[model samples]
Target chain A: MSFINYSSREINCKIVYYGPGLCGKTTNLQYVYRKTNPDQKGKLISLATETERTLFFDFLPLALGDIKGFKVRFHLYTVPGQVFYAASRKLILKGVDGVVFVADSQIERMEANMESLDDLKINLAEQGYDLDKLPYTVQFNKRDLPNVAPVENMNKLLNPRNIPCFEAVAVTGPGVFETLKNVAKQVLVELKKHY
Target chain B: MSGSDLVMYEEEFGKIDEELQRLYIQTNAKVVFLVDKNGQLIASAGETHDIDTTSLASLTAGNIAATGGIARLLGEKEFTILFHEGEKDNIHISLIGQRIILVVIFDSRSSLGLVRLRVKKVSEALTRIFNDIAAKSEREKSEGKIDESPFAEISDEDIDNLFR
Candidate 1:
């Protein structure tokens, strides 16, 4: 659910980065926070446990330049990837305009990736949003790891919809911006359709 | 809590800003702001220059969401009000119309009872204003009068320019 403030001439959209535990959802946000210009980004907040695992979520507000006259701001959030944090993930998904599934590309984590995707779909449905109708994309993260699954196989299993999947190494920042840009573009286009 | 997007026009925003300003002065708050459930800052008043309101709005919403989750497990409908006290400052958060959040930041100069009393009055005013706005937006949307989105003409080049 985007918020269009005609008085302020601004548009705000929420995007959630979701995946299984240690699949680099926080890494994706950290990379963006580090690379974004100071004026373009706000504080990167992480509500994590003592060992640094995300407990609630990680929030990074980015001000992408104006589209026409409206200042386009995107609030990027990452859910706590641990399975016990399902309630927290559902809370973070409220009013989301788009999603980036940061799937771990390692061959051994295939089950985790599949389960996370199923959870995403179910949670979205519970909130009256169909994953098929929402502006969404997938990122195959950890491509730098040697034991990664083939992109084709990952796409076949995870992305049956074939909606703009990217190969990414989120920690080092390859394909990070690409994934964000694609999803943001799709969200803006969807906003256009609504009006 | 509605599924549709929130569209704030100039008129409704003016009314909301006025209410916030009144609340700010009445409660002697350091800053008062309105945030939608999605954590978008709607309007703010008082001394906000030194604060990072964007981050505050996000965290506040997350806090409310977590509290609401806990309320459900205990078989409660929702915990609509939350207060947090620090060494020198305190925060009073309340839900308005269950769709917007009213956040007041104050210090020892104002007591919680005073803040709560003023907030109740302001919340009533805000709820009426928001209800009117929601109805007006729905009417405009259904009548096809709300079709002035600038993205209608946005090109691929325009979006790529943001990254540059």
Candidate 2:
């Protein structure tokens, strides 16, 4: 859901990053925060458990330039990747306008990724959002790792619907903004119809 | 804005932030933030950056929202305070004005009574600020000029830079 501020001529949409634990969701956000100009981004918030694992979520508000007469603002959020944090994940998904599913590109974590993807679909369905209809994308992260799953294989398994999947090495910032820009574009396009 | 709608007494929020800072220090809490029940950050004190305040504000707001839903189901008009004691830290979530939430995070050293005492007074001040905020937004939506911006003509390059 977007809050269109006619006074400021700004359109604010919330985009959530949904993925399994440690699939570089936070890293992607941290990369964006580091690369963004000071004036255009807000503080990055990470709520981690005692071991520094993301317990709830990490949120970053981004001003994604203006389109037509509206200043486009995207609130990026990442759900805790751990499976037991399903309730927190659902809460974060509320009012989300778009999503970027960051999949861990390792063969060992394939099942976790699949489970998380299933959970994502189920939660989105509960909220009246059909994943196929929503502005959504996928990022196969940690591509640089040696034991990572082959891009072709991962895409075959995850991107069967062919929804803009990117190969990302989030720690090094590769493919991060590409993933974000594509999502932002799709979200804004979705908003254009309503305005 | 109408007289009731425009609370001229709203500028007292800065003073409240200072008071919150004092409470944050006295309680030895690492971070203390105030946000509307809608999840907009009002003011913050103590380690705002060292920890993830953006996520904290939203999560704190989410906590209140979920519990508020439960409260509504139970036929309660409001939910006052909720405490979650974790392994190494604790979060104290309190609802204010049915429109704002006050959250304080502390280590093992802080007590529930101390955080609540501060939230009780802070919420009173914050409630006034949020009401004024709501009033101002309503007024702007009615009075401000609404039109498309020239940035709608932004070049593809400019749009590309935004994601970077």
What is the total number of backbone clashes in candidate 1?
A: 0
Tens digits of per-residue lDDT for model 1, B1-164: 23488999999999999999999999999999999998899999999999999999999999899998999999998999999999999999999888999999999889899999999999999999999988988888789874665767888888889888
Q: Measured by TM-score, how close is model 2 to the native structure?
A: 0.66
Query: In candidate 2, what are the lDDT values of residues B1-164, reduced to their tens digit?
Result: 01111111224455657767887987789788876553545567887767756556676777776776667679997678899988888888887776567788998778878877777876776777667666765664466421242423456665676665
Where does the lowest 10-residue lDDT sum fall in candidate 1 chain A?
A186-195
**Interface RMSD for all numbered candidates:** 2.2, 8.6
Each model's fraction of native contacts: 0.78, 0.19
lDDT of 1 by residue, A46-111 (tens): 999999999999999999999989999999999999999999999999999999999999999999
User: Could you tell me which residue pairs clash in candidate 1?
Assistant: none
lDDT of candidate 2 over A37-127, digit per residue (tens): 9988888888888887888778888876766656677889899999888777887877777899999998999998999999999999987
- The docking category that best describes candidate 2 is incorrect
Query: Candidate 1's error at B69, in angstroms?
Result: 0.5
